[model samples]
Target: MVRAPCCEKMGLKKGPWTPEEDKILISHIQKYGHSNWRALPKQAGLLRCGKSCRLRWINYLRPDIKRGNFTEEEEKTIIKLHEMLGNRWSAIAAKLPGRTDNEIKNVWHTHLKKKIKQKQDSNNQQLYVTVPKCDDLSVIDLSESDNSIIPALPGLIGSPGHSPMSPQPSSSDLSTVTETSGATAETDNIKVEKMDSSDMFFPLLDQDLWSEAELAENSSMELASDSMVAAGFYSNFPRIDDDNDMDFWYNLFVKAGDIEELL
Candidate 1:
């Protein structure tokens, strides 16, 4: 159902409002207040639609309007508010003094959106390192593979005797998995299938890139998959063994008390 135009059949002026029109609209609004916008133009003696006059008054001609560039703080505020509120420009504008919804929407589209896209593209390119898996499939994303394999490292921590090849906690099982400050449950079910052990060691998540220095100082650490790998820690450690003696290796890498350190 298409609605009728605000002033389609009426010969009311449109486009940019001139100084004479601005003065007339301003004088009328100042004296009587904008109580009835649809009847304002005739009262103000301007041949313009009420919609156009109201938009002009609110967006540009308003006395408290801030007409210059947006400050850094304002830009950050807009971005943060947008993440929570989505494209509700009017609501965002309400938080920002002296900015109109139309102005904020324009800045978002014209400048800020492109800046955010470029930053995301740069991050995606940086995180995407490809490792050669086999002769058939030349390379795959390292981060993608981390989702399936456990990282082999010096400070690794996990539940001993749990096989790396054991399935990850399924979505249904996560509800049963709980965390306490310093307790490890046997039923936690975190496991790793022992690998050839010579394969590359990557951080389980992207954020584990903290320096071994930092890890040494801080005994308790949490791992995130989307984090970057720490510098110099990227080198592969000597493969502990090749035999199927899985329990011995699992114990060395994964101890119940310190498994959280593996991150």
Candidate 2:
């Protein structure tokens, strides 16, 4: 007899598993604990090779595995990680809980690349409208903060303190979030939410970025009956609400030249 490749006949998983294969693979592995992929087939009645079985288990069938398309944030993380790790998919995957290297790599190759292409198209349109080629720079000095125009962000990581805008260590960490304050409201019942890890550039999000006039213009609603601009309301910047949010805002401010410190 062909020995049937270990568990080929022992109800081992073979070929593309049906729903039954999924159930059996999951249940059997969970119960027995797949210590040995080579022997698992014989015992689990699966017909897949040990390597194939291992991949199926780790990449697809793991119970704790997170399944779904990567979010925009996750895409950023993967790009950042790829820049740091440089093709080390397995290492990149380790940092992200429930994420598989294969999945991260797939998203990089398929989705992120396309997104960058689209961003470039948008950038081309915005460049003409936002800044005309008059051979003179704007007073806001957005020269240093225009890097967001680039579609792919991986370069920011691997290049070591190099953004198209700045090579300084602080620029890499800070980016540009220049907001002009206008009118900030005073609400005793203020709300603060922790920012996400996805917010890479923060220190620049504080209301300080906005001028009093700008703040008033951007306010969602009047907080007080008299509508007076609150004292020190926006001044206490770098809210430390979340480092990431600060960074996110900083880049946005710099990109728009609304507050030119990043310039």
Candidate 3:
């Protein structure tokens, strides 16, 4: 069997390099220049492999090296890049000005993995509030203004621009998602109106804690009755809205504002 070369035989560092070791490597390189790292280690009086010494100098000890944690946006961009480009750490690192491939890989495995796991967990949560079987299924209550409008929330709106509520993309079909027991019933149409009083803060809501079902049961009356509470919503709730909640139209604006600073 071929034996691996020993540090002593290879004339490389047997342990971690110290300040004294660094000074020696730096002085030798400055005077002789390191055109060939494999030959330089032994000649420079160092016991580290030529490749190891080269990586240390280039990644951390280089004159132009920058060291620090990546910002939140940087992290997100890294995740996007990683998703598109697998474990091409060197390529991902190049996009980042001062980051190294090893560093990016570590963050991808540690931080990115955690965020993806949380996102998956959130997707599993039920956001809607289930109408108990006992509630009169005949006709849910409606106000004088809402009497003419559709009864279901999903029968009214969808992601901005598109019509998730429309019957057949027609103006008349626009207000009737509540017309149930049909050939093609869509996914749960739950509306969750978050009465967030804080302008700058709102934790990530997942399906587990803030499921689509729970959000649908939110009523405007609950929003008007109370706006502030210290408790969480899942423990039966923060406060209740009888009917009619604040318009979630501005919720997108709030979320956009939160990410704007990161850029």
Candidate 4:
């Protein structure tokens, strides 16, 4: 099956877009959002092809797009992914956040590919250096000439017995992990710690306690009314009336400011 050329014979603008064109495309996208690229150019009021508009938005105009040079981590990811999935830039871009496939392709072709080739060539030259032919290969002291050889490809780094990285956790470390897990399980069996008024910093007065306190205070006010208690009387009043009736609200009266702050 044949696919149509992106722009075809349509009189569409090409090459770099102007600032005004960028603004119009951005405004159109912000207002309606991009759903159909084939119909976007007409709606966006641009002479560019749908493909051009899509590329512009995806590579540059998108708000979340990352600009500037590729990071070291990104470079390593690209190289490793290329070794596994060669030239599949879209797949490579999917692994790297905010990077477009087109940008990755350009970077590989323009820079990274050449650098890899040069290194490979240098290693090849070093490995092919002149050495005297000998029937007894064991007699050659290769220990002193180690740096003249090319290092093995880093792709084989983590294989068994070949890696320079730390070995797998020892039996002692595994035992320590088991002990820690056992301690955590034992902790789960412990009873939940109870909180008191001091811990809460607020007196937990139930409805019954609040009503009883209001009634007592009202009775006290009424009794003192006949005798005309002074203005500062309630402020200086002895609140612990009886051990039997002393309740949660009495504590609330003393620490009302703290409770107010909490509220």
The lDDT for every candidate, in the order shown, is 0.52, 0.47, 0.48, 0.51
Superior candidate under TM-score, 1 versus 2 = 1
Query: What RMSD does each model have against the real structure?
Result: 15.5, 17.2, 15.6, 31.7
TM-score of 3: 0.46
lDDT of 3: 0.48
> CA lDDT of 168 in candidate 4?
32
1-263 per-residue lDDT for model 1 (tens digits): 99867885567787888899999999999999999988898899989888888899999999999999999788777776775567899999999999999999999899777765554343333222222232242222322444422222222232333323223343333221123334354433233322222332332433333344443332332121011121112221122222232332333334332222222
- lDDT by residue for model 2 (21-100), tens: 66777898889898887877667776666766787788888877999877777777766565445678899899888999
Task: Give the CA lDDT, 0 to 100, for residue 62 in model 2.
Answer: 89
Indicate the residue-level lDDT of 18 in model 2: 72
lDDT of 1 at 97: 93
C-alpha-based local distance difference test score of model 2: 0.47
RMSD of 1: 15.5
Model 3: per-residue Cα lDDT over 1-263, one tens digit each = 98655334543446577998888888888889889987788798777888877877767666656578878878877866665566789999889878888888888788876775554233223222222222232333222222122123433343344321112244432221233444243333223221112311223343255443444455432331111111122333322122222233213212212221211
Worst 10 residues of 4 by lDDT: 254-263
* Model 1, CA-based lDDT: 0.52
Per-residue lDDT tens digits of candidate 4, residues 1-263? Answer: 89878785567899998999999999999998999887898998899889999999999999988888998778767776775567789999999989999999999898877765554444333322122222232322222443223112121212233211122333322111011122343222111112121222222233343333444566543333221121111322223334322332222232211211111
List, in order, the clash count of every candidate structure: 15, 34, 29, 0
